[model samples]
Target chain A: MELFAYPFMLRALAGALIIGLAAPALGIYLVQRRLSLIGDGIGHVALTGVGVGLLTNNSPVLTAVVVATIGAVGVELIRERGRTSGDLALALLFYGGIAGGVVLVGLSDDKGNSNLMQYLFGSLITTSPQDIVVIGGLAAAVLAAMLLLRPALFALCNDEEYARVSGLPVRTLNILLAVTTAVTVTIAMRTVGLLLVSALMVVPVAAAQQVTRGFRTTMAAAMLIGLASAGLGVVVSAEADTAPGATTVLMALVAFLGATIGGMIRRNLRRRHNRPPVTTEPPDVVLHG
Target chain B: MSMSVVEVRHLAAGYDGREILRDVSLSVSPGDVVAVLGANGSGKSTLIRTILGLVPLSRGEIELFGTPQPRFRQWARIGYVPQRLGAGSGVPATVGEVVASGRLARRGIFRLPGAADRTAVREALTDVGLLDRINDPVATLSGGQQQRTLIARALAGKPDLLVLDEPNAGVDAASQEAFAAALTRFAGNGGTIVLVLHELGPLRPLIGRTVVVHDGRIAHEGPPPEPAGHHAEPDHDHVHPHADEVKAGICEWAPTEGAKSY
Candidate 1:
């Protein structure tokens, strides 16, 4: 109750809730497409955007959104081209992002280095009302696109060739997924930090799939897990005086371990129940050869 | 404006500037079961892929259902099954979910699946004899069952023409029979078919014609290649060496040890 009394805590909770739903929402497709690391890559790119914002004395969130979008699109295009050098190209881009961010911050001012820690590890003190608005608007957009295009995105991620033959706009959808991934990273940066943003995007989905049977159920369960982890992590971190992002990711991992054990037990029980009865007697319907 | 169901003229295409299909011309009329046969790395897969607009063509043109491929927008009229060994990706999906994707082109992107889409998916599953396994995850099914799921996905579209690449490779005998039966029914209903094959198996009887590709050219195109004597045995299970002989429709008919014609 005391936590809700603070306006800053309220904003942090609201942002976390929005991100809890949105991250894994788009994350399902990324995982399905086997591009789970893409979120991480985009997050790294957002760090450079953050640096750009600090250098220009502009809104870091806005600059990160713009710069990360371009970076995401560039990565998508290279992936589409699929040259042998594509792997090397993406590696360079990812490394360049972190290096660029740190160098830019160092050049900006001594204060910028201190500010960088807040972005890198995430700080509850920085949860401004403006950041909440940006997070809400962008997260809402990501959620809407992901839900409305579920069928199309599922088909594409499940079987890309078939999706193409089935007349879905494969290229457009691929690019759109890239852009949304960028948007999600920027929105989640303040809550989970740039370095740990992909954990929220991926860990919940991984946890959900352990016990779930189908894509739809896995996605639904992941969002719920994400929501719980985000809410719980924020409250606990405030009490324990720890970094919220690290705590949130740890919560998701805990859920993953629980789901894995639960699923194993369930499978064992079903196998035992379905096991055929053992008998030493010969079958009555047996025929001599 | 051509009357052919599929028309490819002098198609030169391959991956990465390496030409696999050279001066390949083929035409299919309505209700024709045309098998494109070749050895491993013979570019048979490349040929069909080129027709489907998957591989970029270096030269020539492809027309599907009388319209130029680039101009062809009636994708709902054609169903395609790629050379997939199994179904289901890193994500979990049921047989019903995978097959329902076949209706995407028919219904378009914005609209959700209605009653008609669901019925078509059910009917397609029935045709593959996989109606019971509709709710099961595709990963749980055997390789053959997954192949049937892919077939059912294509059939669910109700396409006028079906294109499959290696539909029987690595599939079990039972699934092959089911696939043949489904193709029979589709053909009986006046659907055109173009499939890539290494060995016809149960589909041998259904293939009206065969096009043999050798080093990226159509070497032979006529009546289906009849298996030589004991080579046609149902359970020999040999890998079938001698790709050249098979391409020429004349097998040495070597009977592996203890194999018989019955």
Candidate 2:
């Protein structure tokens, strides 16, 4: 009751809820593309964006949106060019992003030390009216973009080569995914911070995948898990005096573990009851690049 | 000869300038089930991908349905199935939805699927004999059924030209037969096919012509080779050494005194 009494708490809760819904919705495509770590990659890259904003006396959140979008594009390019290099390309971008941020913040000013910590740890007390507006606008945009591009995006996610042959603009759609992921992380950082935002994007999705067979169902399940985790974490952190971002991410992990165990139990029961096979026969694995 | 479905002249293509396809030239006419045969890495896949504009050609001309590659836009006229449908192809959607997506180029993205689109999807599934499994997630399908789903997806588009890269690769025998039947039905309706293949398998009878690719060049372009006795057993999955020699027999059959157009 005391927590709801404050306007700032209300704003923070609102912001967290928006991100909770938006992250996993956007995450559906990324996970399908096998670019799950891209959220963290963009999250780390946004640090440099934040540092640049502080130095330029501009809005750090806005700067994060810009820099991370470009960084997401960079990851897409590297991914395209370095398919043979495997995770080496992703590793380079991930480390380069965080290391670049640390050096930039270190050189900007001594006062930037706390701004750095605030971005990394997520200072819930600092949720301003302006933050809520930006978060809301971006969340709505992300959601609508996903809806409009659903068919084309689904084709690309299902198979890039097939999509290309089908005449979908493969490169443009890949860029669209990168841009949305960037914005997803920027808005998500408002609630979950830079470090744990990736977990918010992916963990709920992992859990959703365990129980759902269809893509739409998996996406809906993930969004629900994300909202539940985010809402509960915010409330729990308020009462327990814990870090909101870390707590929310931890809750998502708990849900994933629960889903995994529950899935295992169901599989065993199916075996005992002699039900039809859950999935199709052994997937015919093919090796072609 | 009726303005051939696909025409490639002196097409040279490769990844990163390594040149996997060297001065390759081929043409497919309507209602022709032309099989592009090759050993692994011999550029058969590259040749088909080049025609579809998936691969860039460095120094040649590719005209799809008479429109040059770059200026061509009616992608709905062509249906393509690549060599691999690897485990849900990395995303799992329902069979009907997956088949419906084949209509994207035809129906466009902004509007919802129409009655025609639905009919196309249903008929495609029926053609593949997977109409009953339309609501199931593609992941819940067996290997053969999944390939059938992909075939249904291609069929739903109702393309005049169908380009498949190794339709039989890594798929179960049941799927291979289903795919062959679907192709047969498509051919009956006047669809032209350009297939990339290693072994003809059950599809041997459908192939009207065979073009063999070797070391980035067209080794043979003529009558489908004899059903190498090696594969006569139906159960032998491996291409035996004698069969390889028979497939490679094109070299001696060349008309120009071993000038390489075997």
Candidate 3:
């Protein structure tokens, strides 16, 4: 297909590969911690950031990064303030952010900016070299952070209180994690858009978790699943002339469902094969009621 | 002649605004096994929480190893096993990983585990009789096994003092015996222990002293009485059916006012 012949297509493919790898690495931790929706919440915040940047004639990526970072820190602060659940907090912030972005976009006089829709829903074919570089840098930083903080992340996922008691400086680690999430969400927004970014964040990890038992194995599986989804989604989009972002998310969804069903079937087969003979008497029989 | 490992002088602590423990005082010398006994809601857990620096002390002061409790760095010297191990459902971890986390305070934030840390973890697991099940997921373990894993986690730190809140609650008889034996070994090794317990039947013999807390205060404090063999019923005006063995040469008549029945 000579897909790499075009510079823009090459950049787009490289960007997708880098993001697909980094997102799941970060997403595995977020999903395990039940903060999968934080990506969606912060990505929506990035939309408002893009609108603000566009209105001000500034770089949208920079604005998005700044806004996403602020939004991530705000989310962590809100979580610390009260007993409100993380999902509820994310939902509230997401709605508020989308409303603000919608209002900002509507108020803008730039009616002829047809590319704005691409930013909203993603246009991988039109990805620039700058986007590729930004995504690559972000992916490298995220991978490094994940490698260095694997143990802390494990502690955070398993037992945060234990992490804190162990003198892990849990508050600082949490803030660092949120900052990484912000960067990942902001960069991934270029491929999956704001609303659909969480799908990419959660689906690969969910699918991987269904098949893998260990933490390292699950993370590896998730990264592989994400890369497959991104690559297949790009190819399908090219052949069928569809939106790459939506195609990628749909592919991830399919993988998730397939893995879930496969896991269930495997479990059922194992149960049947390992079944013991039935007992006439109950295992726990008390003399008195 | 060394100072007591932990000393709580007239400490009052609680959650949010309401006070749960009022003017409770206790001290634990090195190698002492002090049991804080009381009915539920009598502030036994609150006392442990206060000592561990989990709860704020509303009144009075606490000294750990002869130092005031405000210092954060010294927290590494103390170990804690909360009541609920494997808290709630969906806790995805193995017993070894959970126990290894106890060394976090000693390891600090940036550094990874060293050879010594792994050795301590292995020893702790062996001490708790969970060495064989190190790789088993904590959620899949029985209640007693989970508790032992928690104890192993605490022991991994090799703390000078171990504070446990209701470690024996809801544990099976076998696990209870194992836990008691572990505590005895810990005490023999010159490690101090402070625990909150309800139903001290299985643990009564191991405990050196019992401190009864009532209405957030220290109601009684003395060495636990020796285990008297099964006693025949004494003809008394008010005979309590549950009175099997008396301890400390003190017979406590059931309180008439605000006394909660077990």
Candidate 4:
């Protein structure tokens, strides 16, 4: 009751809950597509966007969305062309982003490093009302996009080559995933911070996949796990006066371990029941003629 | 209405920039079970990929059901079973769900599956003889069952033409029998098939015509090779010694071009 009493805490909870639903929803596609690390890449580029916003006295969220989107589309293009090897292109952009963010934040000495720290580690204690609206709006967009392209995205993630032959626009669908990933990363950066954002995107999904049998079920379960971890992380951190972002990611990790263990136990039980009792009635051995 | 399901003229296609199908021509008429056979890297796979519009053509034309490749959009009418992609891994897919995806090309992206889609999916599973295991994870099935799942997925779309690439490679005898039975049923319904194969094996009886690709060119095209006692025994070894012929064929292209001619 007291946790939700503070306005800032309420705002933070709203943002976290929205992200809890949105991140893993998009993360399922990324994980299925085998591009789980793309979230990390987009988050890194988003840091530079934050730096630009700080330097220009504008909305960091807006800037981060733009910069990260461009980064994602660029990554998809390079991946499509496959001219250069490795994640060289993404790694370069990532390094450049962190460096640029550090320089710009250092230059903008208005509120000292604490101003940047909030975005870096998340500031559930100071979440403004405007922040809640933007996070909610971004969350709505991501969910709407997922609903609109669910089928095509499922087939694309299931098998890219097969989807192409199925007459789904593979290139456009690819761009859709990239753009959504970027958007998910940008908004999520505010709640879990760019450093631990993927914890919300990927970890819960990993946990859900361990327990669920089919893709759709895994997706739904991941969202529930994500919401629980993120919400609990926010409330617990608020009450305990700790970093919400780190605590949230820790909760997700714990959930993943729990899911993995639960899944293993279930599978072992099934194996035991399915197996016939160790039989000793093997006396009908074939005799050489 | 063109009775031909597929037509390719002087097709040249390969990965990236290099070409694999040097100058291959192929045509398949409705109700024909045509098999494209060749050894590894012989470009039989490339030939089928080119025809399906998966692999880009450097030079040549492809027409499916009377429409040019670029203009064709009735993907629902064409069933495709790609080579050796066992049922999805990591995230599990049910035999039913995988079969349902086949309906996506037909059902479009705007809505969920209706009654017709569900019926099609169920019927496809039954066609593959996996109706009882419709809810089972596809990965739990053996190698052959997985291939049948892929075939059933294609069948769910009620495609008039089926293009299968090495559907039997790595498949077990039982699974192959199931697959053959499914194909037989499909053929009985007047479905045309263009299959790329290493060898006809279980499918030998169903094949009406055989086209062998060597060095990216059509090496032979005629009535299905008299099934060699070992396979029209005359078809593979008797008619064409696979090894010596491949050596001669590769040597013809290898010395002048290079290894992996694309």
Model number with the top TM-score: 1
Scored against the native two-chain complex, candidate 1 gets a DockQ of: 0.30
Off by over 4 Å in 2: A85-90, A107-112, A276-289, B86-91, B227-262
Instruction: Return model 3's CA RMSD, one decimal.
Output: 8.1
Worst 10 residues of 1 chain B by lDDT: B253-262
Q: After superposition, how far is residue B140 of candidate 3 from its true place, in Å?
A: 2.0
> CA lDDT of each candidate?
0.84, 0.81, 0.76, 0.80
* TM-score winner between candidates 2 and 4: 4
Best model number under DockQ: 1
Rate residue A201 of model 4 by lDDT. Answer: 87
Query: Which candidate do you rate higher for TM-score, 1 or 4?
Result: 1
Ranked by lDDT from best down, the candidates are 1, 2, 4, 3
Model 3 error, position A59 (Å): 1.6
In the range B38-65, model 3's lDDT, one tens digit per residue, is 8889998888878877678999999888
- Model no. 4, DockQ: 0.25
lDDT top scorer: 1
Arrange candidates by DockQ, descending: 1, 2, 4, 3
Q: Model 4, range A1-289, lDDT digits (tens) per residue?
A: 6758877778888888899989999998888777778898888888888887877888888888988888889889988876466478778888887787777777764447787777677666666788788888878988888867777788888877778778888899899888988898888887888888877888999999877757778888989999999899998887787888899998999999998888778767766787642221112122222
Better of 2 and 3 by DockQ: 2
For residues A1-289, write the lDDT of model 3, one tens digit per residue: 5766888877777777777888888987787777777888888888788878777878777888898899999998887665547657778788877777776666666633465676678877777888788889888999889877777777776666666556566778788888998898888888877778778878998888766545666778889999999888877877788888899989988998998899778767766787752221112212321
Interface RMSDs of all predictions?
9.9, 11.1, 9.9, 10.7
**DockQ of all predictions against the true structure, Cα-based:** 0.30, 0.27, 0.15, 0.25
- Count clashing residue pairs per candidate: 0, 0, 1, 7
